[model samples]
Target: MIKTLIIDEETVNVLSYASIKPLWFTDYQIPLSLEQRIKRVQISDKLFLISEKTTSESKLLVIKVNSNGIFSELDNKDKSIAFDRVITIALSQFGESISPGKGWGRYVSGKKLSIYATKRTQKNKNRLYFDTSPIDTNHIFAYALDSNNNGFENIEVDESLFLDSVTLIDEAINSSWQNTVEADDKTQYGIELTEDLYRSFGECLNFEQWYENKLTNEQRSFVDKSYDEPVRLKGAAGTGKTLALAVKILKDAYRFETEKKQKRLLFVTHSFVTAQLVEDMLNSMDSEMNWKFLEHVKIKIVSLYDLAQELLNYNLKKFTPISKDGKEGRKLQFEILEEVLTKKLLEAKFKVGVLGKCGDNFKSAMESKESRKPLLLEILNEFACVLDAENIVMGSDNGDKYLTSSRENWQMHLPTEHERRAVLELHMGFRKYLKDLNVLSMDQMIADLNRYLMSHEWNHICEDEGYDGVFVDELHCFTRPERMVFHELFRLNKSFETKKLPLFMAYDIKQSVDDNFICTVKKGSGSALINSTNVGKTNLVELTQVFRYTPEIAKFLSDLDGSFPALDLASEWSELTLKTNTPSGAIPKLSLYSDPVDLIDNVFKLASRQARSLSGKKTVAILCSNFDLFEEYLIAGRIKKYYEPISSRDDVTKLGRLKGKCIFSMPEYVAGLQFDMVYLINLDKVEVDEDNPSCGAYRRFVSRVYLGASRAKEELHISACESRQGYSPILQPALSSNSLLMS
Candidate 1:
């Protein structure tokens, strides 16, 4: 696609060629000795240039003229002096990282063009004609390669960056930290902090700096060292919440294992696969914040579910929960899993218990939620006698308080037992994990009791210690039942004055709104009550700057058909520059022509490709909003050549496995966690389901449209029938109109 014109013995004559665009890049150079500097010269009244070895390659001088003239016409004397010139190049050296029209654009120059100044400014209205207009360069040169020209030496054609920009970034971080660390201060960048934690803001810079992208003070600030209590984080698709969580996990683990050796921190998520991913991320570079010196730390990573399941599975396989299995006085074990579901455990027990439960066909009691409770209770009654009530009931106190704003209906309900029960289990499980991890005893749970009442027993529970803190992520995703459980524990802590209480809880509540999560309770349920002094005021931190999207992409996200709520929040820094006039196309395409039959063909092909990751490698899931849609995609004609779509796996390992690559296909119920990278496909359909109003059967069917989209890292490849434009509210920072095609 590119051609070069050589000037062996040039007598330049080309002038005024293209009418629409008056000029093009033309270069003139002279070969000079390594020791030679540049002999400066002035051409006309506007141009001055010289040859120097400063920018990597030593070359001839450059001249930009406003009038009609070529290099060979440069008077007999100047032309003759260039006889030693070896080569000349007209190049677009990956020059433009900045899009001038996209909000306050600034040109970041390199050392080669270090002395030049780009367009000082463009009046706001001038951009109106920007699409069909020529660039307003202010007749000044803008960018360069490097201070010494060797800057982008190894940069790929597609991945070039300005090295000097990193220095500017380092400066910004050093300048802002003293003023930016707080939950209530307003910054020059307009970012608001939600917590009062400060780390060297500059210290958080990532590889993006060379690409002219870096996290803002707010985004940087949000990546806290630790959370005092369970927290929620919300952000658009591009936001760095996940990255922050990854970092938080690392720091917490490092502190617990190194500084507070006795304590442990738990990174809990919904699925075993996600837990595995959390493990992978914890091991990623992002988590190694202070790497060069992070020695003497020991830690283990596992999902809350996996850990519990492993313990239970250990008991199931090696021993029995009933007395028949025990020796030293039948240590009948039971787990009140700090988990949302016991899928793996149930699956394992189901097969074991189904071996003729009675006469004809009795499924394992453990396999059925319905049958397990009765059987377990029978076992528990005989082994572990009931001495206490399970789970906490946390809410509020004083008079006239209600979960809802209006106490008109005392009998009105906010959450049924189904929701409350899940909340309770998770909360109790969290505390239990903390207790075990810290090696704390029942007495230790209340050792620092200043006012909170977290103690169930007042005796030494552990002869050792536990994790420094507990990290309860995605709190927004939890049901109200879970929160009720949290209330009891914290209320107890408050009453007993447990100095061991969490320093704080980190949450991004913004996502909660989309999850359809609301704080609610029965009338006079203590939900409306608060600290007497802090009663009217609820303390919160807000992040105003969004560092994820480029300025251009950020604007498109804000303006895209009004589907995305871009403007509602502002960005401290822009990562993209809008290069297109209007976003009309740009969908990663998986074209299905002809009738609906074409789509059906691709569907099956999609499923076949997914059946490969079920092995010990990792869990992989294929997702679609509906089962029929899943079938349609699995049966697609073209893609069907590669896949064999089906719901049940005869043996998860039959499909074979991949190294470093894992993917699985399943219904929404199966799509609960994350993977190293995720590719969402055939997602064109969007129709409302009448049943399951609690958003239980909404677009996500399993994941809320809001939740499913959040489950990926670094890459999000969606194959949809809709154009990128049609994918309005669903995807933020709309893909550029100049999109890349995907089959």
Candidate 2:
């Protein structure tokens, strides 16, 4: 029995739907492109095509399969059934165009029938394949308003009236029938009854079937939860913050479409690679939705730098990005600063300022004896934090007062007034240099954007329809300058009355890759980095449910947790209580090797052997603090032949294909990914000194190690050469607590 169908004109006879089942129909003459017709097949099988040259006296061409056992008037010798029929009975019973829900007299003894149409032929309609296949008995009836303004409700009719009612209609009187056939796929023509027909007609539809896997209850709650005010979701690594953000954007897009409102979403992250991963995961969830209008929903997933470029229109005539990778950018600025500093300090005899506090001379300070290049590079690296902080701080005010006030808050030492002046001079010189060259560094770009937003041009963004919500993943990694960009964007609020916006951020301060990148808006801090006083207040929500880690791994991570003396740990650090089982896997292991080379070799061997044995499909990841050493091992062991290096910017969509192979990754990139087994190497690289100011640095190091340790689903292997750098003091507790199988 055929129940429903679609048809079109121009009518190439594609017999893609020849089976005896509950059939549905559409017009063959309907306006649909070739690509759309192929996609339409995924939901609907049958098509009902009407002829172009039909008249009141014209005959009909009916094409069906011989196995359906319907047209006895047509011989089944050649496998396909084709016949002509009169229109009088069908036209009178079902209306002008022949369709389901009405009678086809004397066909299959009044058994149900359905007719559908296609604009184009999917396959050769003349050739029919026979089958002894069982027939579908279920009937589905669904309706959506047809934009054609036709009298009949566009409903999926039952397959009972069996006259292959190839109907002929009066063309002059039924001219509207031709218009219905040529209407575009836009909803104004009619609501697309495809999904509803596929579901209600045959089986009860589950719109959420695409989300059946991946998210846990807590993650889903965060994705679906609604908030009138801004929110910050904090969680440790592997707690699905990134995935939840993507899901939330998808749900928001869906809701916007359902409500007939424009959808605009802005998702900001730290790395281009991470942004790509979010895009891939979102595309995976619903491949059927029209991605053509992705921008209509304002679905933008971009790195912070990319967002800056976009807002600036990427016109080099406007502002060129500093070519820091070459001789032009910060490198040139460093050289200029070195020359000026060296001359000034030489004049002061490597001065002690007026206070006679001594500092290093420019030449000795700029060059590292070991590398023979500039040690200025190392100092400048440290200076970057102050530079960024000052740039953002100066955004609100001039550099003099902000620079004076922020000197004490910097990461590096500038004890003397001369050294502080030198730092400010270097900053002024760099700003002048960039101004002359029409260029800006990343931080400078953000500062410029902040300034631009303060002008009248920003009124367009404020008044126009922008993002309904803003989601920032890896929020902890944002520096003050980068966060200033967020602040400026949020300031352009759509809700002018309350001056409030819908913003959501996800971060784990414990998973802060660099302590320098930490948000300055701590618990008792009078000021907010993003300028929202609601920071760490009721707007903050912590996700404590750990979905990725096993109980064994969770137990180990909890033991390694350290108190952040500066932070309100209770708010920023979400505790992990494992939500999964251990499932009798290997206890976490500590493998000590004789040397670094031996350690790398053994780790690769172990990962390869595990790849073959652990279900033959388990993934292995090697996490380390050193990327230089990771690359060396990859070349020495030919590890690239066996596995992929995922620490760099590449299409993350290809990661799934490389599963069961050992992937090398930096600890920072492991934020939202997992593996069956994880090897945390170079443990000795992190020195956990309890007595120094670097105790905070040690906590940051421990946090990175804990992130890697918790990535393992079944096994975790930690390797170090005690002879080289000695076992880390931080790992001593896990080593002695009987939680690790130390060898």
Candidate 3:
């Protein structure tokens, strides 16, 4: 057997270690500058002498590297086969000396092999040892390759002697390699390897081979380019915006570490779950680099809410943050809003016959129990985005300013001045309720935090402790108040007091799920955080390469984007170009069921089939468009066996627990997450009318569907129950273009 293969640095970089069937070892630590010439002196088909040419004098350096070091480089099948072959050879050569007891053969089966060498003490001989546990230092004697010297030298030996020498060299290498392995183990090398394999599986799901993580020219330019002002990264879903941000963060972290320059960098996301996902992504991007060292550089990953809480804590502002216990928090907020609205209505003494200035529709909605929820939601949006964001206190001077100000974004929810006044009253009641409870809403927290940061005291504090650079992900999802906080969070430079630091924002206007989110980049628009001046002065890299999904999915998303009225309106200001680099995939399927029961049944059946097709190793997400369906599916007896409910509040640890299981969640919860296959159920519940496609509800529906469908890396399955009115008009574009298959 050709047990050893020698290669130079160039060859090692591009070698496909998995393709080499016979168990062989190669040195990966060869220096590229050596320029060593290698000559293979073939002794036999299974044995060869590789002579290396050195500058000083050519000498034989027979080094046998530990195979365990490269164990992770091989595929799972190759790893198992290699382990079996090693164990088989050990048993045949040394018999019981290698076997510890009667079940030893079965015990070591399928386990990774690790080798160790013990020093010659008074009671022990200089012999090699083997075990399945990589951490174990002492183990049973498998076999010994006799050697007089501790290191290799220029010498000639017979075939058997050469084999023994090679084995002795391998043992020597393993002994020294143990310390390095121990260090790597401390850095979570095993977890990183598993994550790498997970990423590899995602890459090969649709394609036959794994593609390199090489960045496109545009992406590379954006990542490597230095900027003094703010830079905005714009792209549609799967266009590698987040990837570019992560890479830039890593590159800067490494560069700063190398230069021994302490830098304070902040990676801000919309939610904690997304922050955790970004942290995991950064770790996986460069597994070998010890990320702990970056702590000295002060690189922090935090959500906007978390950053607000931190600021509040630093300033000793005592208030409870809103509950993040999944849907419970949102439900509580809704209930509180309802209570406030009811109290306001009662205080106004508005009855069925006698309506207030708010209009008949508003009074009717408030009177009807079933209609209250939607009205409450609209009121909440208006309160949060307009009143709270603008720091408008009801019955105050700011309130008058808000009443007189041009309500551009509020036109959809609160068009008339009377409706706006009613909403302000409700907002005032809501604020009073929260004040009594000492709890802060997300909008309130950001507004309060921004106010604090604007003060002179905070200006001094930030000057000393502020970040050198800021990286914002999901920029389109951030509200105007949250976006304003970034300006004060970075170190204040006297030269650019009115401007920002080296801020990098990754956004896709089409992915903005919130109706309140500002999605314009025009200068002085007051909607976008990064204006055209900043973008033009720095850089606005629009990445068109969609590497996350297949060309088919990209085509479908593009078609959907083109047909969406709101997205079409957005295109006048921002561009969305999706060009995929992946192989052609199966067209996304839209399955219409007779009813909810049939829809649920077919979703599971299809998800199960997809799971089995991927050998039950790939992840699948069953996304519900509404909370009702999500709750209903939780108790669906069939789902208990295959699906796990993933909440928005779930941390990375909770996510790890549901690793190979299908995840059941809403589109909002799985914002930054990806799956091998996605089954977006209850599309009918999204509810968009063709006549009102430009309405807030319609835009939200479009965003929800786009967000859910983009989560599928390989395949997408969208199912909805067929009502008397037939399918949702949202699917018309995909259906018309044949981008979606009717199943």
Candidate 4:
């Protein structure tokens, strides 16, 4: 006897009504009469069909019967079968009439079942369930279905209800059939199977994937280009030089790969932080390809100093550098010179007759410690000038000319021959003293590498084997001497084969903040060690598209640099605008406070607000001029627990503190790093002049502020104490502009 089950609206909504047509009912092998009556079917170990339905006064009555259910059960005792087997039988019922497309999958939620046949253009889906409760007095079979916006008019159904035509492509239930749960044994007449079957599918993308997805077409073209010779890529801040460099490196590595041979690529940067970032990018790119394929294409990313140290010690010789620990070693050198001068003065009875006409002031300055500091610094500066220009790394002709120019530019007067002789002796003696201790300062090490590379051994080695490609990021921080060393070490390949080695350099000259190591190209007409014209073999590619900043921020940065080349907005910059929640038309914020405390407070408030907008892994920074001020602000802000102070020293190893925290950084150390927001403090301390474009102080100030401003990808909040000396006159135009948003 067949019984009828009364269904309510809530039950119908939960069971999601959907159509299921019998396109291949003959594959089920049920009798023609039974197949005709089978209006809706529920799939499990046994199949139950709702042959007929009737609408009562207040409910809908559905009759479901299981007479010789077509699907066979693997386990009869428990009435269980494989979930995949049920899908296979159900799919076969449709057979060749319905193109299965990319096969079929099912999703189960409690008693409800959702199955979909996926195709590239369209999806055919169905939902099913079977239940029999004695209180209900009959078995009920439910079905749910939907289409993926590809239009449902093409879908044919025999005896099933249609759901609203909402897109179900993203619905998680489409793949839920990968898991199976057993029904209760005492569910009256339904089948129950105890088994666990779940499988995870689909591709999982990492962070780099999301980032690279927005690469602009021009940037992609540059990255994908195969260079036959060295290429120098110049760009302003936010121009994605580092990303392009990484892509170029990967392209070169794989493009030059041979069946039995491989090429070596060396990527050098200015700081450990930047080097680590490059290395991480390379590793991520490498993982996308077969690891075995990359075995031959070995890539080493390191700082310039690291390369210097390795090359210096490559011959099993230990030439350790003496640690000055914040001292430039000039003070000790000055003391030695003073002692020698004092001895000479005593030998000459402190007489003006025996020494020179200008000896009296020099003697007085040397006698007192307070008066001697500046004079000593001057002498040291001149001495370094001589050493740098005369170093073995530079070309002999230019080195000699530079040495002559240095002597001509000397400020101090040593008129008498004896006094001049004594000064020369002091300089020579200082050199001897350093050599006696077997200690080489960075200067001495650079000179040593220069001499070593110029030797016959290095010349022969380069002829046989040389780096296939040399990629340098943050190239703006490399001084003339360093650039010369890099050029000779890599570019002095006497043999230009079928493929000329590529030396790729990426830098923004405006970001060179450190006075001691400013970019070589802007030094002078003749000072560029890596210029395209000066060096006829080199190629210059300017990446004129900015990606990291909005047009407002980019224009502001351009104003700060004054001399920085203009750039176009990147196509991908629209995505950056979408990600950054800053209001449209917002310029970099510049605020002047009467009180230092209020300035710090306001900066922190802004930082806190910006931090909320970024993910936990994103970083924020409070950049100051020096360490002492950084510490004071870090303590006063009462946020030392959440922030770490990064050092400005050359050997800083505190990179592990960069992620998921705020940082107190100096302009020099923060190069090649970006934060979601930057609080540039102590701007009043920077010295600047509007009248004198040639002023070194003004240029340095502009460079430093440019670095600080560019470090911010999303927001830049600059504050200055009203009473301070303040920054350069170059910023006057920006400050006076109405769009600058001064508070």
Q: Could you tell me which residue pairs clash in candidate 4?
A: 106-177, 107-176, 107-177, 684-726, 688-728
What's the number of clashes in each of the models?
Answer: 81, 39, 0, 5
Give candidate 2's TM-score.
0.61
For residues 1-743, could you state the per-residue lDDT of candidate 1 as single tens digits? 10111110111101101011111123222212211322222222322222221222211122222232222223333322112111111111111100111111212222111211112233211100000101321111122221122322332211011122211222322231111122223312221111101111223333233113444454445554334433334444445554565565565555555664544444544333333334434433443324322444434344332232232332123221111101101111224331313533444332343222332212344346643533332222211111111212224231112222332232212233322332233333434553453322121121222112234342222112223344444444333332222333222234324333342223333333222122222233332212111112232333434443233333433333222222112331122222222223223333423333444445434434453443323323344444455655555556544433323211121122222223334432222234323445544434333343233223233233333333432233445554322222233324444232334
| Weakest lDDT window of 10 consecutive positions for candidate 2 | 194-203
lDDT of 1: 0.30
| TM-score computed on alpha carbons, candidate 1 | 0.38
State TM-scores per candidate.
Answer: 0.38, 0.61, 0.67, 0.56
> Which regions of candidate 4 deviate over 4 angstroms?
1-213, 258-261, 288-295, 314-318, 322-438, 463-465, 490-492, 497-501, 515-535, 563-586, 595-598, 601-617, 626-642, 649-661, 725-728
**Alpha-carbon RMSD to native, per candidate:** 25.2, 19.3, 17.1, 24.7
Give the candidates in order of lDDT, highest first.
Answer: 3, 2, 4, 1
Which candidate leads the pack in lDDT?
3
**Residue 671's lDDT in candidate 1:** 28
Give the per-residue lDDT of model 3 (tens digit) for 246-317. Answer: 778877777788888878888887755566556556655654335534645777777776576557762133
lDDT of each: 0.30, 0.49, 0.57, 0.47
Off by over 4 Å in 3: 1-213, 288-291, 294-296, 314-318, 323-332, 342-355, 365-378, 400-417, 498-500, 518-529, 532-538, 567-576, 609-615, 635-642, 651-653
For model 3 the local lDDT of residue 317 reads 39
- Candidate 2 Cα errors over 4 Å, as ranges: 1-217, 291-296, 315-413, 425-439, 490-499, 519-538, 563-570, 574-576, 581-584, 609-616, 627-647, 650-661, 693-696
